[model samples]
Target: MRLLATAAVITLSSIAVAPALAQTMPVAPSVLPDGTLLDVTATGKTTRVPDLATIRAGVVTQAATAAAALSDNANRMSAVLSALKQAGIQPRDIATANVSLQPQYRYEDNKPPVITGYQATNNVSIRFRNIAKSGAILDALVAQGANQIDGPNLSLDQPDAALDEARVDAVKRAQARAQLYAKAAGLSVSRILTIAEGGEIAGPPPPMPVYRMAAAKAADTQVMPGESDVTVTITVRFLLK
Candidate 1:
């Protein structure tokens, strides 16, 4: 009987002590001894010539009836697609951007608006891998039936290399700034706590001249893809000794 009683007391005591041990456990320190944290943000930029261009071309047609307007737009749009294919543009590179039909309105002085005619519009966005021939392709589109042309938004197909270069520059700048600040404070950089990339910023493409197809034989449009800047920002944290 005495042995059984002692065993029960021992088990109860162990259970009580387990909770106490857990409550008194040590946690890792979030900061070092007398540590000073430094945060610096630096931007790096590099320029590269764009290799790809995205062109938006479409046809706008007007007729007295909705069916007539839609039929006319379809026919014109078909010609534009055919021209793009003839220029070595694959089907995967072309996509329909927008298609809409709306009623035109004319307002008279102090009178209700009148429905003038129906207008139909169809637009497609084309990706040109060979930017050298893009200008000629645009000219061909105009010769076909494309009346409205928007842009050849120039860009790089693979920007990873350029972005990596920018990142390296950013880190170098950050380290330089951190070292300067640390020296002014009579401290040395102990270790890097963390490095976080903010993001990459791509500069806008150069403006394109808008074109209206008035004649079948329009001069070949000249496309100049200027240099574009790729920028990167990095935030670094360092622990000072």
Candidate 2:
């Protein structure tokens, strides 16, 4: 009984000391100083020639019945896929963007709408690594029964390097502005307190001119991949002394 009473007293003492130990531990400071802080946002932009192209090509077929329309669309799409493969586009680079079969309605004056026929559409998005040959590939797709073609959205395959360059520029600009502000206030920039990225990394710009191809034969298309601009924005907080 005496030994049990001693053990119980020791456990109680340890429990009482735990909170004091925690209180004695040091905590890292969240803010740099209790001084004035300046927050600045800066954007940096860089232009680069696009090395990649994304093409959207598809086939649309109309028939009296949904099955016939779908069948015609499938056959045309198959030919388009074959042409893509022949143009050196890998299977992984091609993806189905959309597929739909809808009934065509004919509206008459003061009369109820009537279903005339069904139209089927199948769209595929293709990523072309070789930008130079993209035009030729598009021409081939048209030859292979691709009635609808949109875009050759030009972009960079690896945008990280460009974005990193923009980030460096942004930081430099922010620091310059901070120094200017501190000097104007008769103070010096002590140190950077924190940095946060803001705004979206700009995406590939819109295609320059939109083109619509009919069922008629088209000559070799000429595609001009112009330069694209990449922009980055950052917010920086600095302590003034």
Candidate 2, superposed: residue stretches over 4 Å from native:
1-32, 209-218
RMSD values, in order shown: 17.9, 17.2
By TM-score, how accurate is candidate 1? 0.79
Scanning candidate 2 in windows of ten residues, the lowest lDDT window is: 5-14
Q: Which stretches of candidate 1 lie over 4 Å from their true place?
A: 1-33, 209-218
* Per-residue lDDT of model 1, residues 141-186, tens digit only: 8889899888877777887787778779878888887788779778
Residue 147 deviation, candidate 1, in Å? 1.1
lDDT of 2 by residue, 102-171 (tens): 9999999999999999999999999988887888888888889999988877767787787777779878
CA shift at 147, candidate 2, in angstroms? Answer: 1.1
Residue 157's lDDT in candidate 1: 80
lDDT score at residue 89, model 2, on the 0-100 scale: 96
Alpha-carbon shift of residue 125 in model 2 (angstroms): 0.4
